[model samples]
Target: MTPLKSGTQFSFDLLAGALTGRDAARATGTLHVLGNPGGRIHLRDGGVICVESPGSPGPDALLLRTGRLSESEWTAALTTGTRGTIGETELHVVAMMATHDAAFTVVAGEVEDCVFTPQTLDTAVAMSVAIDPVRLLQETSRRITSLLALPCSLSPHRDRVAPVPGADLHDLAPVREEILAHATGRRTTRDIAFAAGRSVYPVTIEACRMVTDGLMTVVAGTSVIATAAQPLVPLRPRKPPTRRPPTQMPPTQMPPAENPLPEPPEGDDGDDVPLPRSLRRQLLPKLFKQPERKKL
Candidate 1:
């Protein structure tokens, strides 16, 4: 099976939307999808009956290859509705499983578009039951959750794995053993499923377990390398720069006081110089005009 392509995004919600619309209208037809492993979803009264995808093993492939029914037996079931050993109930179970499984691969990958062809199944096909589309999509979501929870998330279509050298293989489950035996570093888990004559889900899950057990390693240059979520370190807030106090200036010095008056010399009080006019007038009153006895 081709893995979901990188760079082209697809979501389960898109598939859900399409199915929900069909369910509301009670439309019966085939929803043909185009993508990496594009295929068709056949609906009966808005319920999904069969899903066919290049990336998945359909009911016919599972039934015929798994040896539940031989070629002649399958043809009889299709042609004459004869279920000799594995009866019609077996056919229904196989068909349901195939539809659910194929729907998962389709949703997990990319879908370019879904164009509904208004038609009904002829009376010749092996599948006679129509599955609830809502239930199918819900189960697809559950499968996605289970896949993401795996210790190692291996894309069935993207990541090819290789068996570890010198690894112990005794007493292991048949499915895991089959996975390791077919792991050649070039074939992906989907391919391994085909080779082992098994379904994609079990093979992929086994591959994940092998990866976790260290019995296998994903080949280099696969998309599965970066599929797991990485832990992030929380960022610390930045601190403000430290402020310096303003520089202190020395106290300002006052200049020496200037001498406004000259220092007095000794005996400088002896009057030698003429008095000012204002001072003479003041002194003459007491000095002369001795009354009016005057110049007698």
Candidate 2:
């Protein structure tokens, strides 16, 4: 399909138009961003269900950042092919927040290369809950304004942060203090956000202010080290491995064993008795002897 022209109309505008028309139909599909940091938005029943971008930190990171779910639990859930027992409402809220965050990050830039594809059961992610379309639109609108107001230095997933030596920390909010405390020169805004158990959006925005205020400094081209303590992203459960058919075993044959009985002692009273060959022979002989006995 020809990509949508990026003027007054955006992918979101198109989606809203389609979903809210007189037909009042539901839309389930993926919106593909075709720019440098491309992304996908999964929708269900005209509501945003999930959002993902190569350039953005996802919902899993936001979930982990809240400290509501432990690393071990998250890992086990992913490994077991289950989302665990997190409440539907909670997950929906998290998904909504992440969707807005990602959408804001990706759509704020030039979107001339964006496209949408209607998805069916074969293509869309199976989702049990979805964010309300109105709510999602509202939140996205809010974040766009918030995003535009943010400092350009506050790069969401790219910039590294470091605390200034001998900086006064008394005036900082608790969340900001937590973020600042974890800002080693080695960690990026993303890493600090993970360590502080906060979302990247707010944490990076605050970190940017700190940089401007001389409380923290930005480090160039620092790479993040993956660790058990700090999982930078959420992990999805893997599909079960395919099983192979059982191999047939070859049959084996063995010689039949012989049965043997022990012989009786010579002249023993309990010696093996001679057996009559047939019942008729023994009966006919006995009947003839009965007639002779009668004559005697």
Candidate 3:
């Protein structure tokens, strides 16, 4: 008989170890794999389960098996995880542990036609222990299918109406408009995205940025609370004067005029003539006006 490779034999031994206390090891039987690359194993108590290709059991089964799930536990975990649908292949196995009465059978296949025998024990254990390459491969296929069916995780960084940190201001133009529109405080990030015709991720990021920049305040949902104007400071009051009031003056009567004009000395030039009183009075007002104009 050809000796199995270290890696292949190792995997087989590891699975067998899990069945140490099980009746499968006590019963005399052969482990057989069919289709494509067929293989077989015969062991009495302390026998191990192995496969040429790890993919033989499928990804999900392999993961669970590798994770060391018990027979019943494996069944329960797989069932719960795959409650939705099973797309692709199936796992089938028949094992006689200890006595014929202790025989166990498991069939892990498409979600539509999954069949497990002896429901007395949970399906998890049976699936885990009886997993072959074929079943493992089918589990892997199912895992991929289930993953695809799940809703994508939403980006935590995205904000629809509020500005977020590290967001590009230029790209936020549409977000800004939307924020202004439903800003009536009725809409949320979802609402802003719907109204702006933009993705919720970018919109939310932009809104967060705006809030951080102080250009806008995030109120409830799509609406942003506008910044309040700062109040003006009042001028200081003037202090009252401590000095005494000025004295009142009495009115005076006009004095009688003497000579109307004085004659110039002999040989005096006309250039030395005194200016007229009326002209002097008019000139004073003009001078006062000029000073007032300068102050203005």
Candidate 4:
């Protein structure tokens, strides 16, 4: 199949267009990417300070929806970024995480075109940070490469995934557990990411892995993947790794083995191999060579 021309490439081209050529590095404004899942990329000089997309949750959603920040607290923090308050540090990190996540979402889908509005990006809010455009684009490209390389090629923005019926589910991590619990046909991976308070790329990748493992499936009509008659490859259930049952040892076949864990260094007396350093020091201080007293 032909490669997607408008995914990350278009965003990179549009963004790069503003930063390249003669005297374009000083360009400052919001680049409005216009499309179904498009949003604004605010820049100053050459750095991207903010990226907002309807397709993906922003810092506000990352905080509010996840209960990480209350509306009052969010407002107070934004209003007062003083030290000892909610602080800009946490807000900065959240904004940065959301910016990258939103960028991936924007570039993962179709962007019709972008318009550069000649307006300076405002960083008065605690939730905005200056990000290098080159770095952002590189990260977006890397995310695209990783997402496409997955076994189930799915879009977080467009693919509304559903959990497989009566699928064997066991020992799921918190992320996957939340994904499984919240993945109705109505919610896209973007929605699930917002609901689960996670970055969308990993959520999308996990959904793809789940699809491949038969623990989940793309909603009947909501995926480019499902639109294809068959997936890139036939997906079958992947059994989670299981521990083998201890079998009765045959006297003829079995060899005597004492320790399952690593043995201590040879010639070391009163040493406990499995004990931690602190415990070992406490239990057997004499075994440790004392630092020789300096001659006074």
RMSD of each: 42.4, 36.8, 44.4, 19.2
Number of the top lDDT candidate: 1
Q: Write the per-residue lDDT of candidate 2 for residues 137-228, one digit (tens) a residue.
A: 44544443343333433545455678888988787778777877798887766567557655555666667667778888766555233222
Q: Model 1, 219-252: lDDT tens per residue?
A: 8776534542332111121255356567855545
For all candidates in order, the CA lDDT equals: 0.64, 0.52, 0.30, 0.62
TM-score of each: 0.69, 0.54, 0.19, 0.67
Q: State the lDDT of candidate 3 residue by residue for 249-272, as single tens digits.
A: 444533422222232232212122
> What's the candidate order when arranged by decreasing TM-score?
1, 4, 2, 3
Error of 1 at 32 (Å): 0.8
Q: Top TM-score: which candidate number?
A: 1
Candidate 2: where is the Cα deviation over 4 Å? Answer: 1-25, 65-67, 75-85, 108-112, 120-129, 132-135, 150-153, 157-159, 170-172, 185-188, 194-197, 219-296
- Candidate 2, residue 292: the lDDT equals 27
Lowest-scoring 10 consecutive residues by lDDT in candidate 2?
228-237
lDDT of 3: 0.30
Instruction: Give the candidates in order of lDDT, highest first.
Output: 1, 4, 2, 3
